[model samples]
Target: MSSGSFIMSILDEAPTLAQPRSTPKHEFKGHKSNIWSFVFLHDNVHIVSGSEDGMMCKWDCDTGLLVGEPWESEGGSINALALSPDGKTISCGRYNGSVEMWNTDGEMSEDILTGHTTWVSALSWSPSGAHIASGSNDGIILIQKAGNGEVEPEVGLMKMRQLEGRVMCLAYSHLGDRIASGAYNKTICILDNNTGKLLVGPIEDLGGLMKSVVWSLDDSKLYSASDKFARVFDSTEGTELYRFEHESFIYSVALSPKHNVLACVGEDGVAQLWDTESHEPLGQLFHQEDRKLLRCMSFSRDGQYLAYGGDHENITLWVLRVIAPELLVRAFMIILQVEKPYSRTLHPCLHHSPASRQVLSP
Candidate 1:
């Protein structure tokens, strides 16, 4: 099937449900400074986070506990973190303008990719696990070969592209052939991964600094989050598709790999979920006070949960639940104390049914 046709089919199957609410399940806290970036490990049972405290640490998802000794970044604070597609290594971008990789198994140094002249703000691993892409405040994007600790800075890193503003975020397309990067200049650039050539943009003039960018699972659309908006654009043509407005500056956006939901968090401290196909708001999960800005968000590979961290030191985990219409109505009724038998029988299908009786039971 053609790529466009395949993407359409995927979008048609994307789930559509009423706005759902999320409940926080776990809170992992330990970082001494703001947690800037994080990514889920391949197993979904662990997560690694980078912090302004100049440390990167792993945590157990199930227990909400630290997994190993924190890796110290002696040069400066860590600004970005990404896991290799094979799940074998973790890469971190530091304020000192260096990218460091560590083996997940032994937590030992794997490689250090250095070339950026300013803080490395973004990092993405190609879906094939063969390359690591990084962006820096120096306004350059670098693609480096993923390897053991043998790569020398002089020969290992290749300059991919240079932009007019700081590269704030980077994401590899699902096909592993293209990359989408957001920059402080309020634009998005699409590049060919293999040849490091521009394919679509400097898609110009977004209203604010582009904080995050993500590609759809089918690689048909690119989504970006910036000040007060999350937008979808045609991945191939670079045409604007939809714009989702927010109450405040948006800090991060994530697309679920297992579901059709797109999640975003912002300065409002509310994590909003939207339907990918319709571009409609789904539901919202509130984090700290509205004054606190949420900086990062990530979805699990299975799409079962979402994790976000921000101005606060603790990381919050939320479970995603898809509720049936009947159950949803019943839950609303119970919460409202609508206990009368007549009220319970309002739905003709539920009249005198065992489910109705169960719902009405004290």
Candidate 2:
């Protein structure tokens, strides 16, 4: 094996510390207004955020430094942001009822898309990076192609749907075959992306206004955030599976892709982590103050890092330690399995050999 691989193997066999507690790793500041949405890029090393100040900023996760000058949006206060699957571009939703796309690798240009009649509140990119979905207060959802350049405002476009109430959040399934949207009317809708048919919901009156919606890694379950709780639902049956209680209204929920960790942040000023299968609280990460609501949270694709924004104008990054303890135990077991037979052959106590029996007969 290569020297690097050998070193890594040695490190893996070493006794690891207890689940490493999360600490405030880095803080990205300078949003003049509240940051409404942020997402980690696919590379997991960069984060892009949008704010009510009409600014979109990118940051390097390792250094907590701004990547470039903040990009200004002409659509007024930016409300939501989503990164393309390849991480080369980002889409921003604004209060002016427009969705804009910018190439993150090049100069930031206003590739404005005008479609929504009211403020655009939610934006999500399809898994395949082919389409971008935007939701607005006008009760409309628009799915536009990724490289469409610029678009003009139209009431009923080719890929548009008018739901019951103002759409507040949107998420695309992992397969890119369906879209789930949560609205101001306390309803969650799952629509077939190909046929534009309502597939699952109008999951109405979910205890409070639906603030956010996310899909499980396998796309078999849906998790929604709302007043005082985050609820999980079976994707196929549309039945409630579990309801996670929160101290205050939940603003966002994120599921780890590589582990069964579920994280939620909200009005309580605490980011809580949970075991998705056991329904047990794993840990709580508190903000600087106790009353400021956390507005948005996201998990990196690898599930090793988490990023959240709040009313405090700063975005906080955390290193999630959910899998460390388990890994440590597994490493110990592997060593034990390999050494057990050799130990039994050398140690008489492990086998009832005649000499061992005679010695023990005393």
Candidate 3:
């Protein structure tokens, strides 16, 4: 199973792996309502979730410990949640147009700032953890600076550029230099962090509403989902590099920190694992029959664990290791070739003149 020509030798061969014989490694049970907001923080040691039960709780991602008493939030429906890069500060946004920023010490700022008029759909902190960004269904995006003393978002900046529709998701790149947001207007925006300017042409999908958008570890490309296909796009040029079709709408997508493997969770209760470099699905994860319909999925920072759960009120965590490919690339193609321009004479319709007997160009 080793050779310098290994990749070339197995170009036409498919990938094979030992099948997993057991159920999902861990099944956490606690939430009485649907768990819609889930995220792993502090290097995946802790997981935070918010639900329709009007409460947010933190859990030990490894052991599922209830870190603290769940608090009833003012926002009736928990729309989104975020943990600072340090995992010390957590923020919860609600459907009732209010946001609460909290920490392990308790509520840092209660009823601090509010007014979106709709659900707060997405939230993320800058990589440097200096500022926080939130997007909402009302189409307003805000950037707020954490308070130093006993204050709540004492300093903040509101973006003047509106996406013209509801904001679906927001993400900050690993480098902290760029931020990407998907909107209901059928477009995704990659913005320059320094200037707060839109950089890339709005990335759009055919379905008109993107499910999610995430940046690869190196920030070289972006993985996006729409309808039934997961697509990888060049982060710089906004050009699609690969398109992998799924059986149903992709609920979420996760890329390993090393940027070699990807996991896609679809609406049909199937978790798809793929070799990102080759753009091929390698394995599939199946949940219990009635527990399928996953609404979210996430991978730890180290890529050693994958966790997913949904309306079933349970979180399933799985353990995995990346297996080095024993094959080599025998076939590869570069898509840099330019396409030929239109040639009217090459039309499929036959054209003949009875007088000159020469075909005329349309």
- List the global CA lDDT of all models: 0.76, 0.76, 0.66
User: What is the lDDT, from 0 to 100, of the residue 64 in candidate 3?
Assistant: 60
lDDT of 3 by residue, 1-362 (tens): 43223422343242333323435656777788777677777656767777877777667766766777776756688878777888788778788876677775446465344657788888888888877777888887777665431212422333424467688888899998888888777777888877677788587654747657889878999888766778888889998898878778786777767446777776787777777876755545555457466767777776667787777877777765323221111111111122123122221111222211221211
Worst 10 residues of 1 by lDDT: 10-19
Task: Enumerate clash totals for all models, in the order shown.
Answer: 1, 0, 5
lDDT (Cα) of model 3? 0.66
lDDT of 2 by residue, 1-362 (tens): 75334434544543233324435778898898888998888888988888989988889989989997898846799889988888888888889897787777535554577778878999888889877888888887887777763332441242334356678899999998888989887888888878677789778778788899999989999999978889999987788999998888999999888878788889877888777887876544456454577989988887778889978888998766432333323333455566554333332221334533432243
Superposed model 2: Cα runs more than 4 Å off: 1-22, 149-163, 322-362
Report the error of model 3 at residue 177, Å: 2.0
**All candidates' TM-scores?**
0.80, 0.82, 0.76
Model 1, span 242-342: residue lDDT tens: 98887788999998886677888988787777777666565444567534778999988877778899888778887664322233334435544644433
State in Å the error of residue 69, model 3.
2.9
What lDDT score is found at residue 95 in candidate 1? Answer: 90
Measured on C-alpha atoms, candidate 2 has an lDDT of 0.76
